[model samples]
Target: MNSPGTVHDWVFDAIGTRWTVTTPSPLSRPVLDEVRAEIDRIDLAWSRFRDDSTVAEMARAAGRYPIEESDQPLVDWYRRLYSLTRGAVSPLVGQTLADAGYDADYSLRPAPQVSGVPAWDEVIAGHDGTLELREAALLDVGAAGKGFAADRVAEIVARVTDDFVVDAGGDMVVSPRTRPLRVALEHPMDPTKAIGVVTLDGGAICASASNRRVWADWHHIVDPRTASPVREVLATWVIAPSAMEADGLATALFFTPAAFLRGDFDHHAQGFHHVTIRRNGSVEHTAIPGLELFL
Candidate 1:
């Protein structure tokens, strides 16, 4: 795993997630500490796991008062995700999660009796960054948190070095120098096998599969449209200009129609060069148009 003096790798837990950072230059310990702090800050601002997180605070404050502008980024992010996915991906899925047995924390407790969540459109945004919900809604950004954190960490690392990669679970943001970054897609049913490999010149790559992070026979990804699990595809990988886009799109593609994905998915595939793996271990991948020059 060593890449001479041009690469350094570090791993730690933050934002209720484990993150791995690989960069060109050997960053100072203090710099890595600061990056970890930034990851924590992003999580506290958006995590559903933390009671004091901005999302939880808004959930608690819903109907009592208007949510402040401090949570604007999350609001905007959700709005975009909802719009892009045709409402397949939603922050309002918190209620569905609770109904299915998820509680305030990840202790795997029984689901408490709860009411149904209202429509995603019920969450209204003010001119400023304020948010107003017609009813109390549980907001969860588990779909986007890791990719967002990886993007932020990559930005911080970019300041110190020109080449790097940040992987939060399977989501990654790479800044390559000497060689194209190569990533293998682990089989959902069998981790010992890889469906295929993808080489990235630079940018972000994120994969969402039904097999990862399950609870009580239920997968983490819930279709906001039906408030049920996405069953069409076993796994999807997306590569985009930014980590947030790649992360959110991967989640969205899991529930999107195969027809709707033909052009759009191929666009990103050609743009950033992505590889996808299905449950049956089929490989769907495309190389960037001119990336062979860089490789």
Candidate 2:
């Protein structure tokens, strides 16, 4: 599957992010169409910005809402992350983000005083193939939804070719191949400069940064405890077996220490690594096999 000399690529926008798909040969039209549909399905289920989205319905009123069976796993993963991070990373952060100005209209203006985000246990629960909400609460899966979508698209691409890479924004899933691919680790403050590089044969890599979306002394990565932007960690990148896992872990690293993740986060069984940049101008990384840093 290592036909490095011949590469076929497709680039487009999906789920509010840029995406690219590369393979040894061009995929069939049907396969490409399936990939697009798969992504759209995910957006429809999870997007908070859309009035007709399932999440928006949850936000508007409390009730038992049924979702597609495929979407249950994503909701379960968010539940796991909420428990693992002790509520630091939560789908309940949707209201927190909007109050801080990452709203549906892209309004970056902070409310005078933001309201507190609800706890997962108190607000939401799963009941007989449906999500039961105790009250109207905005849910946000931006932490890992894109990665989950990427993994789903890769599944479609995998049917056509074993050799491919699906990149959704910075979250990527690379199929196994004889030769490795080199990826640059972009600097949080300067996109033109890279803090490091990674040579990868297969698997997924996802990044999260405080620099991507910014407002008045606030950023997208918020601390649910305070409903304020996180200031300690500037950015993080994670590598794991699945893009969903990698993406969630990238955001988790911002709230928890690397040492804690290495010991407790179950991605250890499947193997994972990370690189972190702190707000105080310090850098840290695990002993990742193919990582090289110039910092």
List the pairs of residues colliding in candidate 1.
6-24
Off by over 4 Å in 2: 1-4, 265-271
Model 2, 1-295: lDDT tens digits are 5365788889999888899999888888899899888888888888999999989999999999997887777788888888778898899999888988899998999999898887887998664478899999999999988889999998899988898999988899999977888989999999889999997789999999999998898899988988888889999999988999889989998998767666655655524788999999898887776799988
Q: In model 1, what is the error at residue 137, expressed in angstroms?
A: 2.0
Task: Return the TM-score for candidate 2, rounded to 2 decimals.
Answer: 0.95
* Global fold similarity of model 1 (TM-score): 0.83
What lDDT tens digits, residue by residue, belong to model 1 across residues 91-154?
A: 7888678667665655554355434445665664441445666655677877776777788788
Regions of model 1 farther than 4 Å from truth: 1-6, 63-74, 109-115, 258-284, 287-295
Lowest summed lDDT window (length 10), candidate 2: 262-271
| Native-to-model Cα distance after best TM-score fit, residue 91 in candidate 1, in Å | 0.9
Candidate that would win on TM-score: 2
